[model samples]
Target: MTSPTISQIGEISLIDDIRKQFSQKLRDVTVGIGDDAAVIKPREKYLLLTTDMMVEGVHFDLRFITAYQLGFKLISVNVSDIYAMGGIPRHVLLTIALHKNTPAEFVHMLMNGVKDAMTLYHAVLVGGDLSSTQDGISLSATLIGYAGKYILRSGAHVGDRIYVTGSLGDSACGLHVLKKMKRTVSLNKKNARGSMHSFCKKLGAMHGGPARSGLSWKIVEPLVRRHLMPEARNPQKFIRDATAMIDISDGLLIDLTRLCNEGSTGAKIYEEKIPVSIEMKKAAECLGIDPLTLALTGGEDYELLFTARQGKRVSATCIGEITESQRVIVNASGKERPLSVGGYRHFQ
Candidate 1:
């Protein structure tokens, strides 16, 4: 039987369902849903606030993502901002607008994704609003966090070493693979195990019944997963030593430029030191693209880019160091050139 749509359920029912889904009592929250405003207990630590929006046909394409993945990614994106400041996420507020024709099942899946992500971050859903739209979906989230000592993008100084929490370009390469496959992969734990069979079979069929361009599911899976459901990297391990920080949401060069501009300093990075995964390398080769270009310009990786004082012990990959007045990249052959300030900009 076909499921009902949101219009049939009414707005009040929809709000009630969401409220019940996240009705947990937390010590930090005195009032949650059903209230005019949420009451959060004050904390001694510094409070961090951040918000992000995802619009249909602009920020995302439903054809490439499931409602569950969409919900999870929205939360993760905002949480990354808090983490970039070296803060711990504690509370969340969401605003979602969907067409009246949107299926009830889609709403259920979306809330499931949101709930699971909140649980993962140990955060509570204090409150939010819901509304019906005319055509497509629009989602926004506000994340509140706390930290004893917060890091900023303007804190880097000359002689500080630049570090990245993990490998880059995986998410961008994954996006390329998805565009070729023209399909969505369900990443829920219950269905993730068997998702590969369908992902490979369909993609193979598109390219004459074999993995496309000699790329197997093992290699493609991580790339696509990185794009669909990226996890926010925690900075707790090295937060104390970090002098400056930002998350690579818009691409390495653009975000790095923001950090440099904030501190009024220049940066020099080594191409050999930039971390690129083996999966991305092979996939990029098969797709006839340059891996380094992807690593440098591909955005939405959600990895942390930070700076720390030189000679300090840091566990992350040290890619380069801060310079006095020039931003350049050193090639393997020792060629020096200006760093390109290119990334995902809103208006061209």
Candidate 2:
């Protein structure tokens, strides 16, 4: 006999079943899973908490990733959220749903990844839950951090310089590569040289691999790894002077629109000023997609999009200045036009 599947019960029904398993009252819990994270009030400091879930098909593919990489990516993504809020991460709770036959060694590797990330960020892994799943692995992590002052999306002022940490569109490029590898493997299943296993090993060693003749490894691998294990740029020290801030999980255009809408303001962004990586350009050329659109609409960059006062103590470059028009404008060459607000919407 076959077991019942989650799809058979539906998304809402699965959520209801999970909700029923948890206790009604959780100690020291001011907030819980329904929101970003469970907020617990501390006597001496203000607590900021958030959680992120990584689903196998949606967020990752198990065939191309090692357990160690999966573990690190999971923690890094959540830590990025904490950094976005201008907070110092202190602790994390992990909940993992795994298939029954998964190896214990894989679990150990995942734990090692979590442990390494926690040490790097000064975050402690306090506790969590583990359960069996029928389909694929699911990992969720809740991070608790503290902040003297919280920087929110609704705090922009006119004339503030908009700045972003790091270049964009690397993750989208990486996804393209991974998808291409998968397709190639599917078409040539019997060939050992061009197999998915070979691709996975190549991806794993990409950082240390020999540079291709006439191509720079320095330029290529960083972009691929940027998608795999992006370093969270913690700007808690800089937030004291920030007028408004947001994480660039989505593309710049979309995330900027979010900031504008939240702050009830408008902005002007220069097309030439937006940073574009060389690898992004290469990938765009190969895919026949516009690099600007990728930089504008590609999601999961995890860089911070922030507005700060000119000549502020914190160093930042001005991409554009905020405008009073209540619209997002993009200036390219001598041409100036309004940029459409486009981003990843779950239902749409």
Candidate 3:
């Protein structure tokens, strides 16, 4: 029998089909997949669960990525969600659906990546499922975390200062490299190993470090390898003092807009104060792309965009201030202009 088309089944039906495969366990399960992850009540803490899925073609390309990098990235993305809510990740469960021809060695390498990440983040792999598929590889991880008091997107006050972590746009640089690799594959196929090594060298030179810094080998390699990995800013402690918080999954402008929209306020972001990485700037120049736009609209950085009081006791830098109006503004060249939320829209 032919498989049902994604359009015919729709997202909800597809979710239902997948949900039916799991046998319900555990009592006091207040919520499940519909919201984010499954929420189970503990004796003292509230568990926030979230899961993310990555597919080979749609989410990442294997030609430029190693199995280990893929494994590490899978956990990082899910961990970012927990951090966004000021939660500490406690455990994770990973499910892999691999093509029948996929080598067991490759799978082991991927698991090694997962193991490395768990050790780095101090999270445990409680349990998971494995299966074979006819199509491509798919990895899904369910992350369980604990929060004393959740910092949500809906808690921004009117006078909070917007802050973000780390420099932005490196992931976009990685994506550019992947696109170049795909186009040059035919000519460079014979020298694939050499070419990829050179590409990684260039990427490292741009970033000023080898992709992996020992413990972060899995996490950083994918960012340098395929640009498919998301960052986990791990802002649990930072968000504890924040008035509002959000993950930069949809780019700075878009995710900040979500925070502002939630609080019914506006902002004045200083273009000069925005953090853009050196590697990102070089990559943008090489690709003829605007660095600012990449910082503004490039998605999947996975950094935290949070808000706090202007003089709050936190180690956050204020890139912008909250305003009474409900529109975002960019201050550049001593002139202010309205900023648009033209960020990555998955459906679009």
Candidate 4:
């Protein structure tokens, strides 16, 4: 007989499996999964909770990223969710599944990365589980946080101005650089060692790095790290002054669409106003792709995009303004173009 999939097993049966695996329930959880809802006691009235997952090959490539960096990035992304709401991240529960043959050292290194992130953000790992997978590694992280006051994405009004933290598109360009580097490394495997080294030196010197007859690791390292490791934005201004806000996880345009959807509004952003980093500029020039295009549609930025009333600003560039009409548009050189919905989508 063919083996049954999750649909065949059914939701209740899957819940039973979960209950069996984690039978030791916490004292605070008065009710379990069987009831209408799971209950827990909280010291504070306001609660913030969010979960994020990362999968090998699909979400990340192990060849370019280390276990520690991977762990750090995963937790940092979750923390960004809380920070976007102007909350303080406090607790995390992590679930990790990896191949059975994976080394204990690798696991330890990954946990060490997690610990580093928790310490950095003052978050504690309350609970977790481990499982064996047939192929690559997968991780699920649930982060809980709180705020005395928090911001929502449904409060933006027509007069509000849109702002973005730091620059955009660095991470996408970094991914591009890494892919090029990967291709170069693969091609080097087929070439003579000396010629490969010479070619690498020439490529490195193409930028303004020192021509020491060696590869320039400096020029490309920033972009690569931007992809492998990114920072979460947690600013008080987002909560205190902004009408609505969101973190840039799914490209600028898509996330902006979400924000507009929440508020039942639209927006118009300037092409030159969207910030692109220097490294991204150089890399995009080399790749012959418009840097602004990368900034608009490339996701995983983790920066805050918020709408605040103009002149109520807290050190941010006014990229655009919320519109009463229900369509997002981008303006450039006295011309206007309808914004495309082409961005990172998990299912589509």
Candidate 5:
């Protein structure tokens, strides 16, 4: 039996199904899907708006990732921007363009991912536009959030300390491993635990297997999962004392450079202080890649990197301090080099 495609299902029916899937009643939402536009109630706090796009070839590859993961990541990446400003995500709008021949099952899985992410973030899906594309998929999301007080990248002072909420480089390393495997691994809760043995067997068969180098499923699972479904870090705990903030979406050096540029200041971070997970280290070694390079220059970690004034207690890892004029990275042996930006850029 041939499975139904979007072309066979028709746009009207698909949209109606989508509306039913996301139907929700929220206090702030006056009008949701099935309306011309969404109406949102005004809030007393400051409003934070952000939008992000994920194009098929440019942002992701379907071969290495599932539609479910893609949908979840689309919401996560946008929410990270709001969290970077110390805000609580409230509402969401999505726009998706897909090839008419795309499978209905794929669309359903994608929506399930999106719905799960919306629930995880306590956000409501209000309204969005859907369209047919000639070729690849394009997804965009707009997130609305509220904050009593927001942090900005331009607020750092020369004496502030720089911090990161969690470990880095795992996503980049995971991506590398996935590219080598040339396959997808489902990290969904229901199926992952029972399928580890088969997944490891598949991993072992790839190019003599990095598993031969002691990269077990335990080591590879987290790395790939990080790439597939990264949760945005909420800055509520550190927002009070944060002098400056940005999410590590495009690598530490590039994002830190952005923060420094916004503040018209400089920074000095110690190489030894940058956090790298044990899994990432082992995986990188098996792949013959430098863990520090991935940590410093890789993209899409979504960890919050912020600065705070000295003498205040912060729950994040303090890797550096703000400087008066020069941006540099201090090595373990006291060697200093200019901090150069490196990460994903659309155009060369």
Candidate 6:
């Protein structure tokens, strides 16, 4: 007889069955699995902890990504949370559920990716648990860091200006390029037979066809890498002056809306003031999507968004200002329009 699948056992039962697998405890981790919550030893300095989840199909596509890249991204994303709060990450706890048939080499590569990212940020993987699942792979990362001072979104004042580090919309544009290129390739494969092959090839060329132009891959790979491996901006000189700060996990509009709501203020962002990279602009042009719109709605740039006074000399763009009113507004050309929060939402 075969063992029952995790779905058949239900979540609670599954947890109970797998909980024993991670029975070992660290000295600092006074309490481990099978408790209301894990407890750790008290520390004198300020502690920072943040968690991030990535579902296989929803958040990433394994078709074009390596296990290592995926692993790197998982750790990097969690670290971004720590940095967003003006903290430095020190440790990570990774949990993953995957099909039983996943190769051990794959797991090794994934962990190697995690190691690669941890090395970059100077963090460590202290502990975590693994479980089997019938569904696709799912990963969650809990990161711990510390900071001398905590920067909260509620710290923003009405007179503060809005700033963002690096260019926006590149991640979203990269996603489009990857997905469209895959579809174009798949469609061509399905239709590339006999007389219709030439016709399909032309259509594919028009729609993100890389086979016809070697330059296509050269151009798009960097952008796709941006999506796969987003960097967490460092909190350097700007942290001292920033009243409030956040990482752009969701689109700019939604994340900024969160900052404004927390601060009990409105915001006025200038459209032209939003930064766009030349590569991102090129991707948008090929896809016929407006780069500015992507900047507004695209999520997961992993750059810093903060509120500061006008005189600071940090390497960030002043995209907008905090308003005393009760609504978020965007100024473009000569017209100003009320902006609504748009970007990645968990559920529709």
RMSD in order of candidates: 2.7, 8.6, 9.1, 8.5, 2.5, 7.2
Cα lDDT tens digits, model 5, 1-348, are 666999999989988898899888878888888778999885746989999999999999999999999999999999999999988998999999999999999999899999999899998899888899988899999999998888899999999999998899999988987887787787865676556656555655553564475667788888898999999998876546798999999899999999999999999999999999999998887777788999988889999999999988899999999999899999999999889763333212
lDDT string for model 1 (131-198, tens) is 98988899999999998888999999999999997889999888888887687776654675576756
Global fold similarity of model 6 (TM-score):
0.79
TM-score of every model versus the real structure: 0.93, 0.76, 0.74, 0.78, 0.94, 0.79
lDDT of 3: 0.68
lDDT string, candidate 4, 1-348, tens digits: 544543445445644554453344555445544455455555455789999999998898887677887888899999999988878887677788877566555665577778778778877665566677888889989988877788888889998999999888888877776666563222112443554455445555664443442343444556666666687888674436888989999788888889998999989888889988776776676655678878888878888999998778477667899999756555566577776675333212
Q: Compute the lDDT of residue 101 as modeled in candidate 2.
A: 67
Give the candidate order by descending lDDT.
Answer: 5, 1, 6, 4, 2, 3
Best by lDDT: 5
lDDT of 2 by residue, 123-154 (tens): 76555767779888999999888887778888
lDDT of 6: 0.74
Candidate 1 versus truth, CA RMSD in Å, comes to: 2.7
* Stretches > 4 Å off in candidate 6: 1-44, 183-204, 207-215, 237-239, 326-328, 342-348
Which 10 consecutive residues of model 6 have the lowest summed lDDT?
183-192
What are the runs in model 4 whose C-alpha is more than 4 Å off? 1-43, 183-216, 237-239, 326-328, 343-348
Question: Each model's number of backbone clashes?
Answer: 0, 0, 0, 0, 0, 0
Q: Which stretches of candidate 3 lie over 4 Å from their true place?
A: 1-44, 182-231, 236-240, 343-348
Range of the 10 consecutive residues with the lowest summed lDDT in candidate 4: 183-192
lDDT of each: 0.87, 0.70, 0.68, 0.73, 0.88, 0.74
Measured by TM-score, how close is model 3 to the native structure? 0.74
Error of 6 at 209 (Å): 9.7
**lDDT over C-alpha atoms for residue 205 of model 2:** 45
Q: What TM-score should be assigned to candidate 5?
A: 0.94
Q: Which pairs of residues clash in candidate 6, taking residues 3 or more apart in a chain or in different chains?
A: none
